[model samples]
Target: MKVELVQLAGRDGDTAHNLARALEAIAACAADTDLVVFPETHLMGFPTRDTIAALAEPLDGPTLQAIAQAARAHDIAIAIGMAERDGEHYYNTTVLMTPQGIALRYRKTHLWASDKGIFTAGDRYATALWKGVRVGMLICFDIEFPESARALGQLGAELIIVTNGNMDPYGPTHRTAIMARAMENQAFAVMVNRVGTGDDGLVFAGGSAVVDPFGNLLCEAGREACRQVMVLDFDRLQAARNDYRYLDERRLTLPGERIEHADGRRELMIPQDSF
Candidate 1:
């Protein structure tokens, strides 16, 4: 699977226009690309909750339809983030559109500060399989929590795709975290972040990148332009996993599995009466 991380320059509160341009960018970079990952809130520019809410649209709506069409046209799977409006509530949803017109949606589980009042958090954890590759979806702030990435890794996800709209300039915490999660979980991690400045006097760092399971940076975008595509080798990733064999360490002797809260990290519960 060739995953392409596209660092998009999101338009300021212009969902429709940005979406149309998004298709063009996808078309230009879709060749031999199995998956195309875009930035968070690529459709609706990120900032105020009101602006995000106003730009939200229902599933199978115009924005998604355009995305599906582009996916089908390029024969590639595209993963993107949008402020989704389902009835009266909104979610920071990441939608994965396949070449066959199938869409798997994952709402962001972690809500950043000041965004909790705007978006609803998702309860269920789900990952989608595309072309024999187990892929997991996460948004900007969601990747900050180690639990989310570890959960996906334990669930047999080989690649963690993250869509982000974070713009904390002079800080590289998000970038550092992206590489760390990949290293810790032994999974390929790719993050696509929005570039340029938004309405809130916030300037993005624009360090969109992909890291291997060994935590080595594969490809990264520069500061100025937030648009580039790099191909990732699945064969190399599979070789790495085979050599490490970390997934073989998980073994459950009981029928039912349990999760336990311990200290600050969540841990798998030990089987009862096993002494």
Candidate 2:
């Protein structure tokens, strides 16, 4: 499938402007592209502790509705990040909208630093089927955890999209993590991060990229705001999985089981349950 990564800078506290920018980025891609991805919290930038709630919107809010309309008009699927509100709680969420309407919504499960106080953690992971390809959805820090990507891999996901708002001092770490997730899962991983500065004084690192199952970088962007399109080879992904067979080789154990070594090292065991 043809995927487009939109790397852009968002104006802090300006949802409307950010939405417009996202729409424009989508419009700039080829009409036949199957999907487009945006950075985390693309609607109002990465919110601060005090501004997160103020910018939070319902799942069916106008911002998402507008994006859905655009997806229909463009004949493509769009995945974007935003602050989601469900009654009294707010979440760092990513909504995937298809030409038909909203297909899947994934809330960030691993809260980063101040985010724990501003947004509630999501308890579940989500995946969607786009033209026969099982696409997993994750937000920002969630991809940093191997279990998050492995869970999706266990669910039969062939590709994972990470909507991130990764910022200063840790750009290299985030990029390496994205590549590692792909290599370890034997699946394709697409990471889209925002650029420029935010209200929290953090300058977002814009190294948006697409990594193949073999940990090869298909395409990547620098720190500047730009649009990147890359073709994902399903055959290559399948070939790598068939050759490496990491998923099939993984050992499973009980939920609370632990393996203790004579060297004083302990490891949590994975349950022997196959999805």
Candidate 3:
């Protein structure tokens, strides 16, 4: 599958401008690409509490409708992030729109920084089949937790897409974490992060990239507004899985006893006889 990652700088509190930028990027995507992914909150830059509430829109809002129209016109699947409004509550959501229409909507499960107070956490993880590939969806901080990627891998997701708004001083860390997730899960991982600074003065590091199951970086973008297209090799993915068998050999339960730590002290809890 050929996927395009759009790394762009979003305008703070300007949904209209940001939406236009996103559409322009989508339109500029290479032909024959199966999917295109944009950074988190692509509709509007990550904002303050008041700005978030003000800019949040319903699922059927105009921003998404416009994106869906573009997806249909381009005949490609597009995944982009936005602030979703559902009555009084708002969520950091990623909407995956296919050529037909909206295919999947995933809310950010793990809130980061100010998001904890501005948005409600999502309750479920979602996956969809696109172009014969089992694709899993996750937002920014969700990929930081190993369990998020592992859960999707267990659910038979061969490709995991992370829509992020990660910023400076921690961009390298997030990039390493993404590669680790791909290696451990034996799945292709793609992360699309934004660039430039936000209203809060947070400088986003746009190191958007695609990694193979073997942790090889297929392509990576620097801290600039750009787009990258790469082909995912199913053969390489299968070869990596066959060579490591990490997922197949994983043991969900620890044998005998489990370790515990608290207040700098460690203890072992014995398992029941049923074990």
Candidate 4:
């Protein structure tokens, strides 16, 4: 499948501007592009305590609906992040959108720094079928945890997508993590990080990248706005398993309650560690 990574800046709490920018990028994708991905919190940019509640939208809110429409209009799928408000609680979430509506929604399970108090941690790792590909998602900080991708790998994810908002001095961190994650799971990995500055004055890093199942860097961008198209070779992905299968040959498995949805989505309810 042809995937497009959009690395652009977003104004914190400015949903109007962010939505417009996201839509324009969707409309401008190349004809054969199958999926388009944006950086973390692209919808609400990194909401502050004062603006989080006001800017955060529910899963059924207008912002996601608009994205669903764009997916249909362009005959493509989109994976973008937002500040999701769910009644009494809020989440830093990412959703995969198709013409039919939301195919997958994953809340950031690993909150970074201040996010611990800002959003509730998700308890499950999920994946959904996207045009024959078993696709899973990870938010910015989630990539730092090895178990995060392993959960999805156990669920049979062939492609792992990370929507990131990593800032200065930490761009290299994610760059290394993405490659390792792909190689460790023998799955294709892609990350799209934002550029420019946010409300907190942290400059969002823009080193978005794509790694093949063999852990080769196929495409990469620097600290500037960029858009790139990458075609995934499923044959190569399959090749990664020919010699050895990590999931099959592994000595241990994660403890979780695996759920299989009728619509082809899978989730692993991670068991909380007890003291």
Candidate 5:
């Protein structure tokens, strides 16, 4: 799988500008790229109480419709975050969008500072099949918790995607957390963070990166606006999982089974033992 990480700053509450940049990035992605990811709230930016009502949009709103259109136009899967307005409540959400449509959606489960009163937390983690790979998403502060990535792992995620908005003094924190999350789950991890300063004067950290299953950093961005791409080999996944499997050892001996469908589909099937 080939993925591109977009590290750039977004004007807070400016959907028009951000969406334009996002669409442009999607359109410019390499022809062979399978996915393109952006930072947290890349669409709506950081919505304050005063602007939340105007900036937040429902999943089916024009913003997503535009993004879906971009995904279709580019023939690439796009992973990004936004301020999702769901009826009377709002969520910090991320989604995986394929050419067909939305492949996966995950609301931020653990709200960070300022997110507490503005957004409702998501209760569960989920993954979806994207080009034969099981993909899951996390937001800015979500990767800090081990359980966040673990939940996706249990749901059969082989690739973990994170849309981050981490700022000054905390860049190193997520830098370490992303690698830890992938290593612990024995899955590939990718994180895209925002750069430059925000409306509130908070400087976003732009250390976007990609980590392999064995916790090695394949590529990492500096604290600047940039676009980076990496090719992931599925063979590396098997090489890492061929030994002691973390998914099986972390829980009951359900005897995990890996399936490779002739058409290129791959899956890790483990019987559920409800925790």
Candidate 6:
């Protein structure tokens, strides 16, 4: 599938401008593209805890609706992160919207330091089918944790789309994390981070990139304003799996079932049967 990563400027608390820029990127990359990924909270800049709480909006609010409209018009799928308001509580949510409409929603499971008090943790990882491919979704900080990507990989996801608004401090560390997660899980991973300064003191490093199942760097962006489209060849990914049966050999045993884990950390996480 032709997967595109869009890294753009997200103005703090400016949902309107953010939505407009996101739609514009989707429209620009629509041609010959199957899915487009945006940065975490691309709608509301990654503000401080207090600002994020105030900017949180309902799932069906205008920001999400605007993204859906853009997907429909472009005839492509979109995965984006936003501050989702559910009643009195809110979550760092990532919504996967298809041309037809919203396919699935996955909240960030691993919350950052300040996010602990600001956003609700997700119950589990979720995947949605888009154009015959199993697409997994993860928000910014969620991808930093190995368990998040492994959760999706265990569920038979072929591609994991990560939307991040990663801070600038540990740029290389976070960038390596993407490849590490992808290589360990044997799934194609795509990351889209933001650029420019926001209302807060944080600076975002736009090192948005895509990696193959073997951890090969397909495409990567520097610390600059960038928007690029790269093809995630399904056949090539399958070939890698066929050549090396490592992923299929790894195993994780749950209460009522056992599964494969390319790495040996199978005993750490609880299985579905246990739950």
In order, candidate lDDTs are 0.76, 0.84, 0.83, 0.93, 0.87, 0.79
Q: Give lDDT for model 3.
A: 0.83
Give Cα distance to truth, residue 137, candidate 6, Å: 1.2
Q: TM-score, each model?
A: 0.85, 0.90, 0.89, 0.98, 0.91, 0.89
What are the clash counts of all predictions, listed in order?
Answer: 0, 2, 0, 0, 0, 0
- The digit string of per-residue lDDT tens for model 6 on 123-222 reads 6666667887877888877777887787777777788888888887967877899998888788899999988887667788889999998888888898
At residue 26, what lDDT does model 3 achieve? 82
The C-alpha stretches of model 4 lying farther than 4 A from their native spots are none
Tell me how candidate 2 scores on lDDT: 0.84
Give lDDT tens digits, candidate 2, residues 1-275. 99999998998789999999988888887978999999998987767777877888998889888998899889999999999989998899898889877777788878899587888887666566778887888888887888988877766678899998898888998889999999988899999998998876888999999999998888889999998989988998778977558888889622434444442223333344522
| Candidate ranking (TM-score, best to worst) | 4, 5, 2, 3, 6, 1
The sequence of per-residue lDDT tens digits that candidate 3 reaches over residues 1-275 is 98999998988889999999988988888779899999998896676777777899998988899998999899999999998999888899998899877767788878897797888887666566787787888888888888778767766778899999998888988889899999988899999999998887889999999999988888889999988989888887789877567777988932333222231211222234522
Can you give the lDDT of residue 102 in candidate 3? 71
List the RMSD of every prediction in angstroms: 6.5, 7.5, 8.4, 1.0, 4.5, 4.9
Cα displacement (angstroms), candidate 1, residue 76, comes to 1.0
TM-score, predicted candidate 3 vs. hidden true structure: 0.89
Evaluation by lDDT, superior candidate among 2 and 3: 2
- Most accurate candidate by TM-score: 4
Give the local distance difference test score of model 6: 0.79
Q: Give the least accurate 10-residue stretch of model 5, judged by summed lDDT.
A: 266-275
